[model samples]
Target: MADQYAHSGEDKRPTETPAIRWEEPPEGPVLVLLDQTRLPAEEMELVCTDASALVEAIRSLAVRGAPLLGIAGAYGVALAAVRGFDVDEAAAALAGARPTAVNLAVGVRRALGAYRAALAEGGDGRRAAEAALAAARALHREDAEASARMAGHGLALLDELLPAGGHRVLTHCNTGALVSGGEGTAFAVALAAHRAGRLRRLWVDETRPLLQGARLTAYEAARSGMAYTLLTDNAAGSLFAAGEVDAVLIGADRIAADGSVANKVGSYPLAVLARYHHVPFIVVAPVTTVDPDTPDGASIEVEQRAGHEVTEITAPQASVAGAGGGIAVAPLGTQAYNPAFDVTPPELVTAIVTEEGVVSPVTSEALAELCARARRTTAR
Candidate 1:
């Protein structure tokens, strides 16, 4: 609990804000999050005093990104324990808030395990709660460390794959300091390239139904002083056709045993375009995102969000009267197919970059070995 919002290494950009932090106020401990929905327009903090509030924040995506979800889930359990709530119930609610991200359940289990283990060892409720908080803090620290390692590995892979110094990278959705304890997954790699003067231009896709890339990724890029341009999601094909893209980098919500990646909804299409264009389609994530229990891509359960997310435009400031949260863009009662994420098969992925290393020619055996290596390192 020493540095609740500590990021690893020197501060490269002083203007960046942390997406999540744990704070102890006079009344009780709370999980404070920078409300992402209001990003690029206004900065607001949402303080969650209980697990239920945190659950809503997760469902609403006030705090998101797979790695950050795991960290927030662990802290949610700690908040419940420290507040004298039923730890088991809190863990279940937090883990179940979002189904697609494996990291959420994993984080909840880790904190709950520590709490239970302490209680079983004849420790009182106070001691057990302390153990839970400590577990959450440890996880936060580990994720920051993982983020830094991932950036290093991912940047190296970029350099090796595209020996040309100046790299033009295209990215879908949002992955940055706003999404991780450190810089972030795919975005972190691009940032590393920018720092090394190898980044020529960052082409951002305005991911539809949400526009995370336009709002969030673009915000981070500008804050970091990186040269970037925003484009509609559909325009990616034109960029690929013109050969303006050197590579495509994306972050994963969940990685199945066979190396299939479940990222934001538009990620799979980018992978396909990258494949057709003969560009490297790289996935950058921590080892924790990989789930050995999911046998293949088809087996991975993708979360289906409400249709209104597609039929209507919702923003923190755009509260015009409409069927959904914002102004309605489609006809009244119009149905929409809105899956929060899409799966990209391993065959299309050029490489998978994790804190441990990079895996080219992605296969189940290689992915499993990477996960095993991470587990062994953690155990030691």
Candidate 2:
């Protein structure tokens, strides 16, 4: 069993407990992740001694979210290199651990590239390992900065789209401090609005199959003292019908060249409803999430998960483990098609907000330009 740690103090900030962190102890370097699977109930830390352990955590959704996954991937590479393991193998495994999130692969490649470059420059294993660690730290720092910038851009867009002061934002999944190096993607924007005293309410969707919003987002919101309400995933349409939602904010796992967004499953329905309700449906993500290689929504590979995740209720507090795990919520021999994510085409998106800027009327050309601008800025 992974070791558990309770919050040190009550006065700590809502986001004080970092979702992912790295520590160098006497033994060696270990990547420490705040076990997300046990969150909102128990505060636990999963210490990963190697890339394999980290890979398992990633697969288990113990430390997830698009931006955070990228950070973890980079750190996993650094861990392997620093520990004198096969850097190439570790990078390949981390990158392929989870598909759909382009950031994870991007981060792994960056760290591996740095390590190889150091070797090419006649550096020894230790030096190359240091280079990889530096790359990972740089990516982590950059992601935090990107999160802050995205919040500003997203909040500004929110203000412009809904000039009315008191904004009521609806969000899906668990985009918050748990998801990024900084506050988060869509949830960060809502946090900014709340901090600015312009937010009236935040409606959180209970993301099914895992209930990330109900368990994670609600925990963060409550800690932050934000006015929020949690509703079942299917209850979102009723909220939209009642004109309770002013805008819909969501974070993306991957964004294709044509501005297609692949987010947590059930996001597509929200987009469709947002369009029908004439509400602004915005996607907030960092530029790193945009994948020019994935040409369109059709090309974005959605990961299919085990059917047991749907048929069983895996709560951290559940005492008796059923056949599949937790309590069996479905009958035996029931089969389920559980896709981890769903794609939302560009046409349904009102705007794509990134640290670089917002892309209203999302287009392939505009997304490419945004990615280009971000690269140029990074080069500088």
Instruction: Indicate the residue-level lDDT of 327 in model 2.
Output: 85
lDDT of 2 at 93: 92
User: Which candidate leads the pack in lDDT?
Assistant: 2
Model 2 per-residue lDDT tens digits across residues 1-380:
13446554255564788888889989888898998888777778888888998999999999999999999999999999999889899999999999988889988998999999999999999999999999989988988998899999998999999998799999999999998999999999999999999999999999998999999999899899999999999999999999999999999999999999999999999999999999999999999899999999999999999899898888876675667676888888799899999999999999999999999889999988888998899999
lDDT of 2: 0.91
Clashes (backbone N, CA, C under 3 Å), per candidate, total 0, 0
What residue runs in model 1 are displaced by over 4 Å at the alpha carbon?
Answer: 1-16
Encode model 1's per-residue lDDT on 1-380: one tens digit a residue. 11112223234352356788888989889888878877767777788889998999999888999999999999999999999999899999999999999999999999999999999999999999999999999999998899889989998998999997799999999989888888899999999999999999999998988889988999889888999999999999999999899999999999999999999999999998898889999999999899999999998899999998888887756657776667889999998999999999999999999999998899999998898889899999
Poorest lDDT segment (10 consecutive residues) of candidate 2: 1-10
RMSD of each: 3.7, 1.3
Q: How much lDDT does each candidate structure score?
A: 0.89, 0.91
- lDDT for model 1: 0.89
